[model samples]
Target: MGILNVTPDSFSDGGRYTDVDAAIEHGMDLYRAGADIVDIGGESTRPGAARVDAATEVSRVVPVISGLAAAGVPMSIDTTRAAVASAALAAGASVINDVSGGLADPAMAGVARDAGCPWILMHWRGHSRDMAQLAVYRDVVAEVCTELLARVENATAGGVDPGQIILDPGLGFAKTAEHNWALSRRLDVLVDLGFPVLFGASLKTYLGRLLAGPDGTPRPVDRRADATLATSVLAVAAGAWGVRVHDVAATVDALAVWRATGSPRLAKP
Candidate 1:
């Protein structure tokens, strides 16, 4: 999967693809660079960001999705609102990547159930604006797994098929750097839940922090591609079904190398 943020305030790559033509071109570029699917999000889920209205989100994504769909690029709608997801699906999206894991909107499950497309349920405690306050966890790995299981249960109980569900440990949404690292270290536990796990640690704050300078200033977003690639390789080695990344070619190249080394099969738990 490749990340495409169409909003103006996303932590990274914001304002770069807000134009429909630019967004479509980038989506096609991602596909040509070896992304299986381009995950397009209209809202900014970065910490402390304000929410955009549903109509605005739909307007931002539908045109781009329609353009990409016409060009034969597979796409996923990265949204928590059922209305936005439905519009994107109607515009040619084949998957729903909800960060809130069906907790934000009561109608999201119904939308997923009716569409019968893959639904990505990310482990989330609250909306982005207040999520920083909800990052508390005694055992990060165990708690994330348990919370993801509950989300899976909720998805199934809401009439979505178990097979259609995918799990994502929401990496920077509400997690501190430690929490993110802990989850990454123990990702195999999340994969063991029997659902395909989607790891999305591309250009996140934690990666920037990990590469901080001696002055303690975090590395810039553009400078974190290597870190993102490292995480992608390690996540796949840990049995992640897919990785959401900004640099599709780099990740694809790294995974190809890993495959050539036969590390993927050997590294799986």
Candidate 2:
């Protein structure tokens, strides 16, 4: 998976692909670079980012999705609005990457069920505005697992097929840097939740802090490829079903290497 933010305020690639033509071209490039799916988000979910209305979001991503779909690129609309998901699916996106996990929009599960499309429901407490406050948890991994399981049960009852739901841990959504790292270390717990886990830790601020340079500056997004690859390979090592990433070819290559060695890193003595 490749990240394609079509909003002007997305954290990393904001404003770079806001233009329809440029977004289309970037989507094509992702495909050419061996991306299995390109995740296009019209809303910026960066911490403390403000929300954009559904009309503007739909307008931003629908055409790009349509164009990408027509060109044979499988796309996933990274949105929380049922209306936007419906429109993107109508425009040819195959999956709904809802960062809100239906919390923000009650009709989201219905839309997924009605369409029979796989919905990637991420664990979200609230929107960017107040999510930080909701980050407090007794045991981060246990709480996240419980919450995700509840979501699965609720969605299943709401008519979404069990097989069509992918679970995301909501890495940087409401969690602090420590929370994110703790979640990463405990991905196995999430994978055991009876759903395919989607790991999305691409160029996150937590990672920047982790790989900060000696000069008191964090590594730039353009220079975080090594750390990104490490996180991706770690996700795969932890039995993740899939990893949503910005760079596809690198992850693909790493997976290939991983699989060649029986997908194992080393044997403990």
Compare the candidates by lDDT and give the number of the best one.
1
Model 2, residue 71: C-alpha shift (Å): 0.9
RMSD of each: 1.2, 1.8
Estimate the overall C-alpha local distance difference test score of candidate 2.
0.90
Q: Across residues 77-179, which tens digit of lDDT does each residue of candidate 1 receive? A: 9999999999999999999999999999979999999999999999999998899999998998999889889988888899999999999999987899999
Q: List the residue pairs that clash in candidate 2.
A: none
**Candidate 2's residue-wise lDDT over 89-177, tens digit each?**
99999999999888889899999999999899899999898898998988999999888888888899999999999999999888998
RMSD of 2: 1.8
**Model 1 ranges off by over 4 Å:** 264-269
Where does candidate 2 have its weakest 10-residue lDDT segment? 260-269
Query: Which lDDT value does model 2 have at 183?
Result: 90
